[model samples]
Target: MIGWRLSGALVASGVLLALWWLWGANARLSDDLAAERAARLAAERSAVLARRVAEDEARAQLQGERLNVELKRAAIGRSDPVPDYLLDHLRGLGVVQ
Candidate 1:
């Protein structure tokens, strides 16, 4: 009878210890999942910002090119014949009919 009681106590203690370890592992995994989610959100935000910056740069470059074409046109007015290079540039910009 005493031996049976001792064995029962040992089994119960082992089960309790296993439960405690499982709880700790679950908490650690939850923390890791939360950290991964945060990192993904941060990366998404950075990608959006990078795309905006690239778009702005492209817009600025296009505006600069258009301004240069206008200056070239003004420098050689209606009285002068348009140079072949300038005509090609205007055609490339879809400005020449």
Candidate 2:
């Protein structure tokens, strides 16, 4: 009878240990999944920021080109008489008013 009682206790202990191990594994997996989701969100935000930066750079480059052309035209006009088209444009801007 004592031997049977000992074996039953051992079996119960083994089952409890197995349940504890499985619970820990499930908790660890849950944490890992949450971490992966956070990482994915961060990567998406970085991609959006990079795309915005690229668009801003392109716009700046286009504006720089336009300004360069205007400066060159102004420099040329300084050495010659102003054309009728420029006078009309100045009037449109209220610069000649």
Candidate 3:
């Protein structure tokens, strides 16, 4: 009877040990899955930010080009002959006397 009790106790201990090992492996796998999900989320966020930055840069470039074209047009359309009143003011200031 004592031998039977000892054997039963050993079997229970072995089962408990196996359960503990399985629980530890499951916890490790859960941690790895969480880390992988976090990494994927970060990569997705980075891609969105990169796309936004590229769009902003393109818009800025287009605006800059439009402004440059407007400046060129204004420069080309400028009249060279000064107004008479402005010429008289310059003569009064002795700048064109």
Candidate 4:
């Protein structure tokens, strides 16, 4: 009778050990899957941010060029003859008084 009980106990312990090993393997697989998903998401987010930054830089460059062109046009329009600054002209206008 004691020999039969010892055999039963050994069988139960073997089954428990197998279950523990399976559980550990499953947990490791789940962790690996989660880590892979996180990496994929991070890569996608980085790609989108890089593209947006490139687009923003291009837009800023275009705006700068437009502003430069406008400034050049304004300067050209203001390129007229200079006013006379003689003392006689100031005296006639009563500015020297």
The most accurate candidate by lDDT is 1
| Cand. 4 TM to true fold | 0.71
Backbone collision tally, model 1? 0
- Whole-model lDDT per candidate: 0.84, 0.81, 0.80, 0.76
Per residue, candidate 4 scores C-alpha lDDT tens digits across 1-97 of 9999999999999999999999999999999999999999999999999999999989977876664565456547754432345435644754332
Error of 2 at 73 (Å): 2.7
Residue-level lDDT of model 2, residues 1-97, one tens digit each, is 9999999999999999999999999999999999999999999999999999999989977876665466467668754555668768865855443
The alpha-carbon lDDT assigned to residue 68 of candidate 4 equals 50
Candidate 3: which pairs clash? none
Clashing pairs in 2: none
- Model 1, range 1-97, lDDT digits (tens) per residue? 9999999999999999999999999999999999999999999999999999999989977886875676577667834556779778867976554
RMSD of 1: 5.3
In model 2, what is the error at residue 49, expressed in angstroms?
Answer: 1.6
Give candidate 4 regions above 4 Å deviation: 78-97
Give me the overall lDDT of model 4: 0.76
TM-score of 3: 0.74
Question: Per-residue error at 47 for model 2, in Å?
Answer: 1.2
- Clashing residue pairs found in predicted model 4: none
**Would you estimate the TM-scores of all the predictions?**
0.59, 0.61, 0.74, 0.71
lDDT of 2 at 57: 86
